[model samples]
Target: MIDRRGFLRLGAVGGGAVFMSGLYGKAMAAAGYEDFYFVQLSDSHWGYKGPANPEAQNTLRRAVESVNALAVQPDFIVFTGDLTHTTDDAAERRRRMGEFKQIVGGLKVKDVHFLAGEHDASLDNGAAFHEFFGPSNYSFDHKGVHFIAVDNVSDPGARIGEAQLAWLKADLDKQAKDARIVVLTHRPLFDLAPKWDWATRDGEQAMALLMPYSNVTVFYGHIHQENHHMSGHIAHHAAKSLIFPLPAPGSQDKRTPLPWDPAAPGKGLGFREVEAEAKPVAYQITEFPAMKG
Candidate 1:
């Protein structure tokens, strides 16, 4: 049921994350035209080592292979964030970023975008991340759809802050009221749970700015699982992580990594596909459970 395939039908489920289906198809699209689809990967946490994910490097490699092997090529691929695990040593961080980029460069998809997660922000307020991936916040338009990526995690307080908000407003101001907008960032724009470091301190301001748009959807990562929520007309969807899945928000007293289970090695981990050309965007998600090796 989780891997349903089709287009134009989207369900907005509740409880912290969003789940969507119908992003990838095996058969060729009808001649003369085709729908738009792109793959979303998040929380790769490269350079991480521990029992939580004993085979971290291989998992990342397999993830690339999985996307490359998709029967139909995704229009593009966007990594939501946490590309590298936290490393305090400046040189080490650069090394990790270089390696992460090198590995990801192997992806068959040519157009790839990256975002910065908290771990990536650990060094110099993400100066290192910028050094590796370029600007922390920006936007682009593709096939009449506007995509915006915000940096809400780098701030020590976990805030989108004022400058970026102004940039977002100016960017939105250029678009027509009916324009279709997709927001990409490292964390949810709404307060899923502030106590758990899950909510962006100033996200509400950003949400308020997007309210007037006729069609707006947010695809973000950080929760490390599938979640969906609606803010008025806008929909916010969360994607699963490649490195490891975190506990569901507020599910436990303390935020801790879900123990890597040999029996369910790939559970709660996967990628999402979005059908952007459809009237109402439809998405399909796949979770990878770790396996016994």
Candidate 2:
């Protein structure tokens, strides 16, 4: 059952209320009875140094601090992608990744999962990213949930390709019919915006691979904002960035980073907290800047 109070707080933001409330209620109600709770934080862009966010250096630190400070520590943390900004120098990339590690160094948690974004992978097709992080795509089983991480950013176009698809099928075949499945990627499976190359080229194939599952949820990053759409029984969700926000699809003729409003500088760094087990629970997204201000 949805938490009426929490849903109302999330709904006050506008169109996001219904979806946000529904997800929270559904996840929370299944918490202890179903699965574990985990937090997703994306697009930290650790190397991004700019005045748009004066506290850029400390922003990530603060965000990690907030996560650590949570009364209920999540089972794990998933950083969807964009660990660093685009860079040609290998040393620079290493430095950025190192900084990210430093920020989360004190966190009292276990199991951190990472995915690579186009910015982090496109430069050299994830050569540096993989060296620091592990395999670009992989899967693991926790409790009754089958978690699949797909690599869409490091290629000619955003695609899972044939090798990964085959692995996905073989992996799914091993799980039971009632098992819950969750997929993580840097790009949405649907054509969110073809012009910006935001949509994945082989996403349809990836979706087909997952269609056989009874319960599935796909989580992505890259749009730097939150969006939810239902395709069949599968729920697709995009997370907010820890660095900056982007204009909604078609909201602007050309996509560009939105300027930080002086009155709401830290607004973009907010994130969603999800408990995805059997009975899931999530908090009303607390906008850090708004709350701190």
Of the candidates shown, which would achieve the greatest TM-score relative to the real structure? 1
In model 1, which range of ten residues has the least summed lDDT? 7-16
How many clashes (backbone atoms < 3 Å, residues ≥3 apart in a chain or on different chains) does model 2 have?
A: 12
Positional deviation of residue 130's Cα in model 1 after best superposition, in angstroms: 1.4
What TM-score quantifies how close candidate 2 is to the native fold? 0.84
**Pick by lDDT: which candidate is best?**
1
**What lDDT would candidate 1 get against the real structure?**
0.78
lDDT of 1 at 3: 32
Candidate 2: stretches off by over 4 Å: 1-33, 277-293
Q: TM-score for every candidate vs. truth? A: 0.86, 0.84
Query: lDDT by residue for model 2 over 50-142, one digit each (tens)?
Result: 865666777777778777766567678788988788778878888888777777676778688899998788778888888888898999877
* Tens-digit per-residue lDDT, 1-293, candidate 1: 33333321332131123345322222213232234767789999999999988888788887888777665677799999899989889898889999999998999898999999998894578899999899989898776568999998789789988988999999999987766678999889998877888888899999999988866888899988778888877788888888778888888887788889887667677776676644344444433332222
Q: What is the C-alpha lDDT of each candidate?
A: 0.78, 0.73
lDDT of 2: 0.73
